[model samples]
Target: ERPEEKLEKPCAAVAPKEEALKPKDMDRSTSDDDDEEADGYQQKGVSIDDLSDDWVEAQMKDVTVAVIGNVDSGKSTLVGVLTKGGLDDGRGLARAKVFNFSHEAANGRTSSIAQEIMGFSQSGEQVLIDRMGTSTANSRNQTWQQVVSQSERLVTFSDLCGHEKYLKTTIFGLVGQCPDYTMIIVNANAGFQRMSREHLGIALALRIPFFIVITKIDIAPQNVFDENLAQLHKIVKSNAVKRQPLVVTSEDHLEQAATGIYGKQVCPMFCISNVTGEGLPLLRSFLQRLPSRLQDSGLFKPPSSPAEFHIDSIYVVPGVGLVVGGVVRSGRICPGQHLLLGPDKVSQFKPVMVKTIQYKRVTVEMAESGQHCSFALRSLVKRETLKKSMFRKGMVMLGPELQPKAIWSFKAEARWTVGFDFSSQSILNCALVSAHFASICPAAVCGASRNVDVPVQLCRSHGDQD
Candidate 1:
């Protein structure tokens, strides 16, 4: 049980004459008596209902942008380029591992102290190396949040996946949860395949800020270029992508293609060979120019305040406590600042403690949106419990009380990737939610309460007969 209870001072603190009219605070009395679930005590103690929506929003944090794409599409390699330096020099890749900040003792100006903390030789670049994670799927988000907690200034980077299949499942976890950004990559060597079309559709549907990164162009054949381009045009045209495929074959040859392709799209195309030393400078220049492109799209703007934050991943840090990782999203978060865990499944909670904060590789007083970070909780909370309680899925984590609308049924427009009969008990996985259940959404029009001719949406890839 919590030891000390803070109460507001009396005229301002004292109960008004109207208190006599209140329903004897019976719920409070009972809840206080029960030590196990003290929700009532927690509620009666703090009232933010008196606060205005503007004030509440003023406290809201910025959302984070997670860059994702198909495996080996150079997601990590590209991120390495943007953060460290042009990959051509090889310094970027090496320095990215020990990127940090330094304090200018003479002028009190703090620059990237990477050299000081990791004791690596200093370069002229202002970038750092990010420790993504050991676990490909579970720990990617944690690495991002750690970056947020340790940096003095806000930072943003991609959450590149290790596998191709995981992209489809992980994409939605980032959708609609935060006001952030995304990047998509494609391989010039493979051209635009059928599976790439599926991935493209998902990105288009979300209306995310994504660019087509054509990697491994050094080996691309010029003879089949027209055929590949035509195929890509057909696929993109059918999907209503509204933009033509950007081809980056030669820095000189693809110059016109690169410049014109981004007509209305912000994410540009680049011909980059992670192996060879060609077109690296152009790619670097393009990246340095991207923030401006985003700005023109009205997607990149500096925050007005420091209350913004985004939930990237939730995990239990052994010994230290529950670790929540994410970007500041918008505003600043400091040690000791109270954060509302919000209405939980069984109860509502007020301000909770911000025990610690880390960005990149060092601790900071506070952090802002676009920065990656993680921190420990003063009290304990289960990672799974927090996920369920908060309705979070991968990148999108919400607090308790904002319960997922309990759907007794949902009309799943599932594509049977593998041919199967509907009578066979369809059980495709809900990859994004990471949960699976029998395909048993009830048919509302049925009078006998029997599962009948349900409206089942089928995918062309999978065989499902009506």
Candidate 2:
């Protein structure tokens, strides 16, 4: 018998016993049958409650994954196929949906940081696909709402630029966004390039757990693909990273890899073809089962703590005035709350009122720590003084209680140095430094003593601040 038939047989058999025994006996038998069926379904990886007509909403868990690689590595195409629930036409049909600019579509390259999200239901089914078996823009928005309302997990992908010229933008995406994990794509036919190595080094330096995805397997020759896979395994297991390489081929391997992903010891590699849709299901399963490392670190600030939101992108809408989008690094933010926005030319923060808040394109009254959202700000300064150029990336929106200050000089311990020839009296000026929050700015370095301690002074790079 089919699995569903077998699961329902016990329940159906117990229904006929309604008149054969006492009321209490019949109730007991029915309860026992229900329990048996539920157990059977659970053993087969199915949830009994998920099959019910009455839908109970689940608390959505957000996970950010950054996609990094070299140009033509198929990063955008893979994400488009995964989220849109459609295979590529072996051309650029899938990637066109994700390109935000006309030039990008014409050149078939991504120069800026783009974002796309995929949702998985409690039962591991993708929620973005519609009844017609295709995903449209409107359907995707609707699916996001439905998925957020019904699913237990949501995965947001930050698609970063892969070209060498846009390396700075890619670095900003990696550092400023603070993604939970990194997904590095490598073209199977072309093998790993210089930028791929650079991205991997950045991920390693940041101490973020990452995995590898080998794409374009449908076009690569069998011998060439095998050779590339062997080389990838060698590099991952080399002395530099010292990580165990695991190739996921079955469900058992996938489950074991997903469980060990947080440990940072094993690097799981997936081989997928966006055109043929091979091995995509296994990748989706791994992503769905992957746990958020932020929660594991216990670093999430309590809601009662002071609010702090890091600004990464700024925009001026015609009707919305000023809108800043970024992650809430700590605490909570709500509408109509007053906060400080700056580290201006004089390292002073100015007051601003939050007019509105948005999460995943849906307006919300409050946004909590670790959540990425956009806030519409209403400046308290005079209209003449309020200029969009005054606000730039790497600034923070902080609660007034902390009395935050933008420091020009700070001491830091050196972990390691590379390709540097510095003397004790050397003063490196106009150098760009990236901090823990991924904010990069021009600064001056001084006092590099023998004890490996250095004091750096930050200076405003633009607008005649320095």
Q: For all the candidates, what are their Cα RMSDs to the real structure?
A: 13.9, 19.2
Question: After superposing candidate 2, which stretches have Cα over 4 Å from the reference?
Answer: 1-60, 129-150, 297-300, 381-386, 411-437, 440-466
Model 1 C-alpha lDDT per residue in residues 1-466, reported as the tens digit of each score: 2111221110001113332212233223223223233333334333333433243223322223454545445555555455444353422342233222222222222121111111111231233445543323335345544444443333244343435444433443344232244455566766765445555555554455555666666667875655655665565445266565554545463445434433444234555666574666665444333332222333222433424344545667666566777644444445644343432322233223456676544555454434456765442221222332452322222221222222122334433222111122334342222221111111121111113354432211110111
How would you encode candidate 2's per-residue C-alpha lDDT over 1-466 as one tens digit per residue?
1122112101001112222323233234334444454345335442322332111112337788999999999999998888888899988988887776778878999998878888887788877646422235565556566656666688999999999888877877887788889999999999978889888888887778899999999999999999999999888887667789999988999877987678988999999999999999999999998887654544455555678888878888787788999987666676656577776655566776677787876777567777789998866544433568877776888776666655444445434323111122322433444333344332323233335344333222331121
**lDDT to native, each model:** 0.40, 0.71
Q: How does each model score on TM-score?
A: 0.51, 0.77
Worst lDDT run of 10 residues, candidate 1, spans: 6-15
lDDT of 1: 0.40
